[model samples]
Target chain A: MNKYLERLYNGLIKENPTFVLMLGMCPTLAVTSSAINGLGMGLSTTVVLVFSNLLISAFRKVIPDGVRMPAFIVVVASLVTVVQFIMQAYTPSLSDSLGVYIPLIVVNCIILGRAESYASKNPVLPSIFDGLGMGLGFTVGLTLIGLFRELLGAGQIFGFQVLSLSWFTPITIFVMAPGAFLVLACLVAVMNIVRKKMDAKGKPLAAPTGCITGDCAGCGMSATCTGKRTADHTVKTE
Target chain B: MKELLLIAIGSAIVNNVVLSQFLGICPFLGVSKKTETAAGMGGAVVFVITIASFVTALIYKFILANEYLLRKGIDLTYLQTIVFILVIAALVQFVEMFLKKSMPSLYQSLGVYLPLITTNCAVLGVALTNVTKEYNILESVVNGLATAVGFLIAIVLMAGLREKIEYNDIPKPFQGTAIVLVTACLMSIAFMGFSGMI
Candidate 1:
């Protein structure tokens, strides 16, 4: 695989920020109430991620380690603001639907995580590819969750009535907050089954535990989880 | 007073920051393994979010408002994201320092989580939501406090459930986040029953 292509594959499959790594749960669960909303949120986040990664990579040498987190945030936040303005002007409905989430993108773990882990260490081009891959993976994850939720919750796909509402009473819960969790849980479990099958076939899976690598710190399982140390040590102060 | 009470209750329950609004989910999931940790995190979140909300509301009203920024011959509304995030980052840092000095043990317990709070979406979500809702300073503070309290409630409950589930015979795949999420789903459903309360 070409290096850039490798980055893409890594993000989309190996370490997918959404399905694989499970970063940015806020937007993953929140905006994914509908297919269209998920796609909009995904693409908007992609643009921010790509540009922020590019800029951070380009300035990796200049950003001091002590203030790096705040600096990365400023970069990501500025890009988000620009994206917000563009969406507000060009796509009013998306802008409105996404609402506070658009601005909240500033705190999205994927963007900052990519910036800290990949972009700041790598050269510009690969970092861009990394961002693109991760963003696409997130988009795919969100869109799938959204599609499932929207179909069941509203008997609609992208606002078109796919399942007739009269014949099928929409399982409205699928589109609500609870629905997001249920769908995500099922999807991840399914993904785990598939990964386990593949691993049994001698294929390399993304992370250990197939799809869900439970980091103790993030999961508050530090007292019980043995995998806590790796995350804490790898985390840079900036 | 009734309206304020309603707003507080509504945010804490009906429009819960975690169960409904889906903010601060990272911490809600991550720091919620233990009830004690969850409680501490909740307290820390309440402090940070309440302060961030108050400060951001002031910034929005006194500085970032269209009328105020227009005086400088620029709309500057476009700067909202950058400005809000910076305020949150700075504010979290300040709080970390204050806690470290003013209350050593509290700071020690919060420890790494204090810095982590800077990126928690709930802090920024409340600030931005407050702006969007056109809330006054008092309202923003109340909303932030209520939201964090809601977060505290959800996380502590989740931690208790998670601890119990640890002993249960769970399926292999659902052992980690999947089961936790499913549990959260049930909790979310339970919280949905509160939606009509307001």
Candidate 2:
């Protein structure tokens, strides 16, 4: 139970798929024009992710090593189909709003990444928790961005008039493509600043401290007695 | 023919797959570092998208759209995602085999991109979107081709810019992905100028 909780916590905050790892920006940016669309897409993806992870983790051992990727893809595709049908039947509005993004969830690197990294190695219960946690994290992150965009762009939240006034002229760019990039850039910058401040105060940064490439040798944040040795190699060639 | 050509150009340029529709961004950022690699990746996408669109349309119209299937209560629309992925996977396999046998150099240039196209959202998105829009076979094929070309153009341009950025003095923090994203933001903004054009 503790392990499951830890996985959930890790996925939601410490290692968020969107804001932290920065995977699956396509749908993150494309469908986030409105809060409702973002939530719908996020929940749909969560459904697919949770089911696929559970099934994949359960059959991980039985699947041969050589054919693992294809096998995982098959599982994910099937799950996505099921979710699509459910969405079409129950939530037609969300199904229509998400448009192609709902089906495109099958190709999202986050799901495949988790399937390959965690679910394929872990037990079913843990994988389920991981999926739920990561999905929730993605949902939260997307919803926040969507809220920010929708409120500022159209003076509304979830299609409701949240801020209506004669003086309030919505910034149209907030709902545009550039708006997604601007919001994402600001979020990443804020995260980096927060991480840096924590480091300066001698506090442990969230998640395991490591370089983006999973290598410590060339990382700028690493502390080592021999850090000066590779100083030249670490210099940016560009 | 002219209308089709216009649609191809319009989709490829005015409504780009990556910059405009926000499809296939994983490879856009991941593989757009080098011009040669980006071109190869773009070509692989073009190949897969074109083929997948045709095949999926056939499946939707002939099998799924048949009144008999609807009367039998066998709405295969539920199987859209699974079938599209399977078709894409099979198409990618076929292309890889053909390239490996006939054009090893091309295969090597494409490298892992050929298989990666199987998971690219743009390929599947185009296929599924065609079904949603209810485009005829010819229209679907044209849209797929145009969308792939649009993706190719965006990625290639991005690679070119990234290659040039390699020579420029970038800031400490916004050097790699950050700067590229900023550039992409600008590109997307510029592309938005076409929104009212179409």
Candidate 3:
């Protein structure tokens, strides 16, 4: 496989950001109330992720080592603002539904985690692919959750009636706040089962390194989870 | 007075930052292993978010508002996200230094979590919420405090339950985060009842 393609595959499957790594739980759980909302949020995040990765990787040499976090943040924030404006200009309804989450993407751990651990070290093209792969993985994860919740909660999928209304009363709770948590739990449990099955076949899923704890400190992870090492870790202070 | 109380009650319980709104799940999940640590993190969040809310509100009202910026047909509203993130980063650093010098004991407990707070979405979320809702500084502070308190309540409760679940004989696939998430699901359901209170 081409190295670029490998990066894509890595993000989409082996180290799926949403499920396997669990990096951006805030957006993953929040905007997934409906299928369309989930898709919109995921695509918007993907745009930010791809462009930020490109810019960061392209400028990896010039960014001083000590201030990488803020640099990554500034780059990501600018990209998010661009995406925010585009979203507002083109898709007003989705913009209204997503609301504060667009700005909140600036703080998402996935973008920072990728910048610190991957893009900062890799070249521009591969970084872009990595971003695309991870973005698509996140999109798939969120969209599936949204579809399930929307189908159950509203007896429909993306506003189309999939389940007939007479028999299925639309498990309304599935679309509410609690529904997001429950759906995520079930999906994660299923992923665990698949991992176990794959493990039995002597082909185990790749265990993700760093950012496992979802802390900003974890974003600096290279080999081990720096945030998990309370006393031993010597982090670079800016 | 009644309105302020309602806002407090509404944000703190009816619309919890963690359980319902899902603003700070990263820290809510990460720092919630032990009950004691959870409480400490909650304290740090309350301090940072309350101050952030206050400061960001003032900036929005005074500095970032298009009326205040040049006032010559230049709308700087597009800079909101970038400005907010920078303000939060600088604010967290300043708070850490001030806490360390002025109150060593408080710093000792919250110092570790302070760096982590800069990336926590709840701080920025409250700020943006204040802006979108057009809240005055006072209302923003109250809402921010109430949201942080809500986060504290949810995280502490999650930690307590995780402690109990730690000893239980769980299924193989449901161990670790999956189980924790399941616990969160139930807690989320429990919190849903609070919606009727306000």
Candidate 4:
């Protein structure tokens, strides 16, 4: 139970898919123009992620290693189909708002990454929790960016008027491509600063290194201090 | 012919896949570092997107939306993502095999990027967007081609700028990706100038 909780917590903040790992930047930037849109995308992705992780974990041993990637993609695509249909039928507004992003979630590296890394190796329960946690983390990160952008860019939060329009001229750029980059950059900078402060006070920050480059062996920081110190020393000596 | 040209130009310049519509951003940022490589990637994307759009459109119109399928109460619109992915994956595999057999040099240049395009949201996005917009087959093809060209233009321009930035003295923290993103922001702002043109 404690281990499950630990994994969940780690995924939410320490190894957040969007902010910390930067796994799926396409949807992160593209769909986050408004808070509602961001939430919609985030939840839709979460549903797909959780179900795909569960199914993949259950069938991990059966899937041959050679064809695992294609297999994983098939599972993700099917799950994305389910979510897309449900959204289109029940939440047409969100479906429209999310646009092509909901379908693009099938290609999102985070879902495939989790399935390959955690779900394929871990037990079913832990894998499910991992998915939920990671999905929630991505949702929170996207929503935060969306909230910031919407509030400043359009003076609204989830279409509710949060600020008086007369007081400020909305920075329309925040709702644009440049705004996505600006918000993401600031979020990353802030995360880095927070991590630095945490490290200074003896609380170790979460260091998720297997994402993006997918070269855990080549990362220098992991070698010096993590749990695999003996292996790290051996590699260094060689 | 003029309308088709207008559609192409509109997609390519005014409503760019990357800057305006926010499609295919992964490759726009990921593969747009070197001008030569960007051009190669752009060519590959142009081929993939244009071809995939035509194929997917035909499938959606002929098979999925066929009267028989509708009578059976099976709206395959729900399966758009799955079907499109399968089609794309198969198409990419076929292309890979053809390239390996016919033009090894071109294959080698585009070898690594080919697999990456399988999961490119831009290709799938264009296909899905075409269906939603209810574009006729010819218009869909033109839109897909133009969107790819737009991506090519944006990435090539970005690559040139990044190449120039490499020679300049950039700041400490904003040296690599941070600086590139800042540059992209400025580029996007500049591209917004074209929004009013249409």
**Best model number under TM-score:** 3
> What docking grade does candidate 4 earn?
acceptable
lDDT by residue (A100-203, candidate 2, tens digit) is 88778887877877887789889999999999998988898789889999999999998998787687999989898888777766665666667678779997
Binned by DockQ into CAPRI classes (incorrect, acceptable, medium, high), candidate 1 is medium
Model 1 score (lDDT): 0.82
Write the residue-wise lDDT of candidate 1 on B1-198 in tens digits: 887899899999999898888888777766777898888888888889999999998888778775856887976666777898888877887888888789999887775577667767899899888888888999999999998999989999999999999899989988677898899999999999998898
Model 2's CAPRI class? acceptable
User: C-alpha displacement of A152 in model 4, angstroms?
Assistant: 1.2
State the lDDT at B189 in candidate 2: 91
**Tens digits of lDDT, candidate 4, B1-198:** 887888788889887888767666666766666899889889888888898999999998888787788999987677777888889877877887898899999887776566557767788889988888888899999999999999999999999999899899965545545666677778778887887765
Which candidate achieves the best DockQ against the true structure? Answer: 3
Per-residue lDDT tens digits for candidate 2, residues B44-155, read: 8887789889988998888867679898987877777877787787787787789889999987776467766766678888898788777889989999999998898889
TM match of model 4 to true structure: 0.88
Local accuracy of candidate 3 as per-residue lDDT tens digits, A1-238: 9998998898888888777766678898899988899999999988888999999999999998877777888899899999998999999999999999998989877787788778999999999999999898889878888888999899888989989998889888889888888887776677789878888999976543323343344453222222232523343322
The docking quality of candidate 1, as DockQ, is 0.53
The CA lDDT at B70 in model 4 is 94
Best by lDDT: 3
Q: Candidates' DockQ values?
A: 0.53, 0.30, 0.59, 0.29
* TM-score of each predicted structure versus truth: 0.91, 0.86, 0.93, 0.88
lDDT of each: 0.82, 0.77, 0.83, 0.78
